[model samples]
Target: MDTDVISAAIDFGLQKLSFTEIKINQRKVVESFLAGKDVFFCSPTGSGKSLTFEIAPFVFKYLQKNDMCIVLVISPLTSLMRTQTQALNRKGIKAPNKSSLGDVKEGKIDIIFSSPESLIGHERKLLLDLAKKNFIKTVFVDEAHCIKKFGLPDKKKKKLAYRPCYGRLDEIRSLVGGHVPVVALTATATEETKAVIKKQLCMDNCSEIMVNPDKKNVTYWVHNLPSDDICTNFRWLVNLLRGYKQATSRMIIFFRQIKHMADVYEYLETSLKHDAYIDFKEGGPNDNRNRLFDMFHMKTDDDVKDFICTSYMNPNGNIRVVLCSTSFSMGLDVKGVDTVIHYGPANDVDDYVQESGRAGREPSQQCNAILLTYKRCLGSQNIFPSMKEYVKSKTCRRAFILNIFKTIVEHAHIPHFCCDICRLSCKCACSCEDECVCTNTCNQVLPKINTAIMSNEDNDDSDDNDDNDITELDDMFSSDSDSDVLESSTRKPQVIYSSDDEMF
Candidate 1:
């Protein structure tokens, strides 16, 4: 391991980049790349996963003074590719928008950004050639969970999107062989999903590092409505949003079906009179979708000038709400989303995690997540155990999500404003007509338990001079913290109520 390379990377990040923090996980990731090991990483959204891969190569190239080093990035969406390329260019790195086999052979570009399909179809031979000669240092797959959607397509015509190009990622691995390192990055994935990614990419003995998935600043709420009254549910959602303090804050309303989105969009336009935008497939081409996105972000009018000058004030009533389906879930990065409202229950917990995690990206801003659903639709949508479990569960909502991904942390460390259950708030108003007892205990205040708090020390790898070794990396992974582990006694302990209590 080269300490100089790591140090140089940190210098570049702090001196040149914006809002950059060289986390311990990032340092370990770069170290693994230097040692020639494959990596499988799972962290929460807005955790800066891109920087982990980018810093290592930048540092490596700077140390060797090799401007010819080529790093290939494979993404599922073109929007994501553009986002990364633009960011890299801001850091003074040469990432070409267009390049050919001759350009790659001559090392005309430091990084090449392409979608999975383009890499497999247009640059297949060139990429394999670079791998054969060990010219490519690392092959990165961002949003690696797309492997499940595209790797094995369903024969039934129910899914909205499909791509056979993702299946060919395995071919890239076979040609690259064991000498080259491959890194798979994603914000959310279960252990089973992780296994599929590792196997699909032919990653042998890959290292796994999972950052804490719990988002402490965002509060979760569930609104249970009558299964038969769809109109009433929309009205209820409209009232909720109308009551929020920041009327112009960015919001995404996710619908399970396209028809439901259309229905709600009509109501918001006619009744609430909000400049709401609708985003879904089969509606129009990408140009229209891009226009709608700009409107929602308040980037399309003369008021945009004042909005930017005043830090996004919205004097001209800009578009704030976007009604969308699952297509809006992945690959789109919108910052400071004040709230995320699910028009219905998600297909499963993983989907719920990924969708809801979109909010509270900026740690300083508080965000909320609301799930509106009916009990009857839970089984139809494969929401097993029940949507009632989520709305009525007596446990901390944060704890419930963390337990799903098998994360272990003391309850005392969880934030006080964790969720509706932790705070004992029943906004659902579920009546007993459906045998739901949640309404009965809505007003009861549960006792908070006092326990030892778990804390992780802040480890600053930028200041360290020691070469990053495997032994230090193992300690970081085993402790289950993104950075360093601090002493529990130094922090104040939190009091959280247990979920098993009958009145919780």
Candidate 2:
């Protein structure tokens, strides 16, 4: 890979850009577009991570033959793929998917965008063969966090299944040659998640870069309320939207479940009695998917701005308030997101951070990320206690986030552990933090919960099952931790504080 030529192409692209002036952080990302080095990048949303990878194929084009260098971006959302493919086509680039696989095989496509599920079947083999012949040069995993197994398993099987890939990533990687440099990009990564990703991609020695997580243009706030009074909360949301509507600003509201999404949309359309447009994705004759593309995509005649729907819809609408699930939190970037409201609790701290990071991408906009939950149900079993601890904790949010990554880093280095990436010892120094802040804050806060939830018998059963599967899988595919420092670290002194005033 000629790094100098790649840099020159990036410079040329940025010089002729319009609309938003490219930020310095984005320029730094473009500079790191080198070949033969797997890169793990964590940047805030709207910081131009997509642009960095968008220009990457140009680098390979400089080094390889014309149309010989193909770029494949694996995104989690089909809607996102469609939007990106449309945008790329407008730029006169050939980007196609299974719907147009014929065009791709006819040598009509320079870029191919697909979701993990669509990349698993017979069509993938043909692409894999072409890729091995050097037709596909670079692979980019957008919304890399989905590889960590988002609630897909839970929702699909109605239970939490821990099988990370569901046989997707492993299958896809096997098709592509090992030498093909892979790039994993996300807006949020806990130390644990980073470790998992590195191990999964076999990129232990990969260079890592992160843009500042704390955005000065965005404000963060948390509200505790009663779960039963959800309607009252919806009223507050309406008022919030009204306040922003007066300013003619755009906003997004994230929900936890599809049922809740439907309920909120119904309330807004009926009780609020607003002419605001609503779209739900329950598959049926009247399903939103039937008309979603025509309604949301700018190419359509729909002028609906107050888009009320689940995370499944294409988010191209000039909608003032987009009600969705956490699925909208990753990869897809929208500018002028003035506010992000969480109607329910998040699954974990990592989730909370990713969702909140969506607001205030524009440097001059005053955006706010508000976390609202019921006060009485704060200690509910369904709600992850770690989130409550984060909201109520006194430590710097950045320190807390870094600490999560540090633990995962240490876990990655331990030998004989069958992680997603390798089978042997991992030798990578994850210098992510100035100090380990988790030892004091998160260690002691959950002993009772851990003990109550985790039993010796449960451990034995789970361990036995995991060992049997690990041994079998490791043997089949050839893929696939310390006490003293742990105990002393747990004994450190700590401080705790409470929110004195209610945010709402």
Candidate 3:
């Protein structure tokens, strides 16, 4: 590594990002990029993965003897582009996202961020025109794993993939005319996924800088449920919040689909008002929200769930929760988010790892990654081997995830608490240095959601009951029929639902 590149990392850290020092891995990435290598980089969240792009302009100016350096960033998410653009500009670095190529020629903007579609769209000619003039020094593809999952959506499930432009990213190299180095970076990608990115981005001569994707302070927990429905599996999550009293911890609940995300986001807001709580001892739903809130010393006057439903970049201590989708995974840098809840099966395994990696970013903040879903994740026919094992295997969840990117460590990596499996088996007992380790009895420290409740969820209709549920059904089924016919039909499905049917 060049001494100049090493000095650049320190200079940018101390003067720009306000850090005492940069990591060795971070320094190496900078060195490789500045050497004009098409770099394939992968590291976990909170590892300062963005440092390479942040200090690139400084390194370019230092190398080329130029006053201004232009770096174009091709990111898949719009929210990520906006967040990075805002943060950079606020730091006196004039970076433009979703802006014209006019800014590039103006010679004031240092960094530019955009979605793949934008660069490949009508703006392609303008962007290529700028690249032709050597106005854009280097091109960056942040969250590069998308190049595999979204770019090449499987033929069977092509509709699930929204950004097909990721597959077409190879055109970017031709447009830039091979002068600029395209750096592909992401937090999660298996060796197979890496190969896909390399071919898609045309990084044939790319050097690699990969690191372990395991987050030490983060704990992983999976609750295999009976059903995949949002209302069914997410009950425990609701109860976890209902029973939670902590004001310091922040959370992000991720969903792959927008409808499910909206449904749960809306439910958390109105659940307290609708007596959504279940009391197995007392049997069925009841409104004990005020009692529980008072017990937890929770804030009642504030609209806690009135968090930014759309953009989830800013971390507010007052906002306890933010519901996220696949797009928000890359750019979410909220410092205090210590709890990450992933609902449903991830269409792509990389998205699951990336989304879960968002929590516990701050060194002092211990976080939890809770998986609430059924056995199967998306990618149904072609699931990542390790992801399938990690979900079902009763092994060290931390090690299982780490091996995805194959984190090379000097010795066995000791996590703060290995994971729920390791904790229960006392396998993590040796991992933690403290004199005492949590026994299997310590599950109380975590929430106990009755996932099997879907099997036991019963509607006790009294003989006097004449609610409007029958009307909600299609008219062809029961609009003309008497209430007795509807009752008979409802009972049949309830029997199947109540049975020991975990086939899903």
Candidate 4:
């Protein structure tokens, strides 16, 4: 392994790029790439999966100063492609947009970004020609699950979005030859989908790394929206947002269908608007129009980017709630989203993971991901089996989700900060080593559990004497505690409740 090269690559990522820390799996993926091994790795969305492959060719070029150490990246969405291209350029990598990909052949560019259709249709010969001479050092497949998503042909009427060329991705590998390494990365992939992705991408003997997809900082729950009382269900959200200071807190409401999204947006907009306490002179904040926005596939790429950048990234920007579809999910990383609401069940668990992963990108902030559903969506033919199970499960919500992905972490969060099921049933909410800090992010969607004082086995009030009275306990736990016994209790508790928990 090029140890120095690898170290340099990691440094470049942390210092030049926005990556925060080194993930063990990310390092291993980069090492495998440098060693000329095909790599297939899965980590949570916000974990910076792109850096694993990007660093390989980057370090390769840095080590030998070879402008021909080029990499070809096959991305799924055009929005994602544009986002990455700009990010790469920010770090001084010569990754040109699709319009300027012709420069790749002249060694002026270090990376080439293309969609499956464009790669196979337009740049097929250029890539193949580059591969013939071994100039293309590595091939990358971002959001590799798209091969199964847009590629597979259904027996029923094909949706216009279907593009079977995704299944033909192996042709690019076959033509490029096996001498060049291929790296495939995704935030969500099941065991079955894993086999499919490997076979489709010709990653028969690739080195694989799988990280647990659970995000501890983000809590999870499901809210049943009764069909009979639409206003009642919507009023709940309005009340929750009413308590939050929209400037610092953010929420994302996702929809399976655009029609329903519009309806929900209209209701939320009208409700969230500044209310006159008594038909006041004006209103509290009629600026409600600026408080919400909508994002969907219908919007242009620039519009989507603008929504994300200004609404979430820009502090002065006013958008605190977003009504959107799956279009806002994939590869769109937004930090500090305090809540995420799914208006209905997603088509599958993978889609759920991608869409909900958009929230809580900031490590310091806690997010609550709530899936709102009706009776029909629970058992719908289009819904994934595990997704349905998730809505109905009474056990640990995080445990159930981890089981779906076959991932295990040494420390599962205590019941209180875990999920609705665990919070309601967990006998050991205090088991987590870290002090649990209730961020107040999940009050409306999930129940809160206070495990500070253990309950008596006999359910007796005998142990609840004056010393241990609730009033005194509050003082002990309060910020200004000065008592010797309450010194440690003064600091706020911080049990994260937590893949793409940012990958879309």
Q: Provide TM-scores for the models.
A: 0.70, 0.67, 0.73, 0.76
RMSD of each: 17.2, 16.8, 12.4, 14.4
For candidate 4, the C-alpha RMSD (Å) to the true structure equals 14.4
Residue lDDT tens for model 2, 1-504? 355776566665544232235566555555544546677888877777887667666655655546556777877654466567667777766677447667666555667776555566545776677766767766788878766644124454354533334225756666887776777888778776777677766676776886556555554554444333456656654544443433334566775544445556656555533323233334534333222211221111111211223322333443556666554676665666666777655767667778877877777775666666543334333345576665554444434544554522222212212111221222333333765333222111212211221221122212121112322110100000001111211222211111111000
Which candidate do you rate higher for TM-score, 1 or 3? 3
Residue-level lDDT of model 1, residues 200-296, one tens digit each, is: 8888798888887777778776544544345655664455445541344566777664445555655655564432233323554423222222212
Quote the positional error of residue 324 for candidate 3 in Å. Answer: 2.2
lDDT of each: 0.58, 0.52, 0.60, 0.64
Candidate 4 residue 254 C-alpha distance from true site, Å? 1.7
Model 2 steric clash pairs: 191-405, 199-421, 225-373, 225-374, 225-375, 305-319, 423-480
lDDT score for residue 167 of model 3: 85
Error of 4 at 457 (Å): 33
Order the candidates by TM-score, highest first — what do you get? 4, 3, 1, 2
lDDT (tens digit, per residue) of candidate 4 on 1-504: 558866876676466455567778888887787788899888787888877666756666766667577888887656566666777888787788645656777767777777777767766788777887677888889888877776776556443325667889988988788788889888888897888899998887889998778888778876554442345546655555555434325677776655455566566667856531112236344332344444444332344445555456554456666766565676765666777888777777887887788876766667778887643544334556687777777787777877878877458676666776766654442343565554342333332111100110123323222122222111111110112222211223211101001112
Candidate 1 versus the native: TM-score? 0.70
* Candidate 1 regions with alpha-carbon error over 4 angstroms: 9-21, 98-105, 153-161, 227-231, 236-246, 272-318, 381-394, 409-416, 425-504
User: Residue 191 in candidate 1 has what lDDT?
Assistant: 81
Alpha-carbon error at 245 in model 1, in Å? Answer: 10
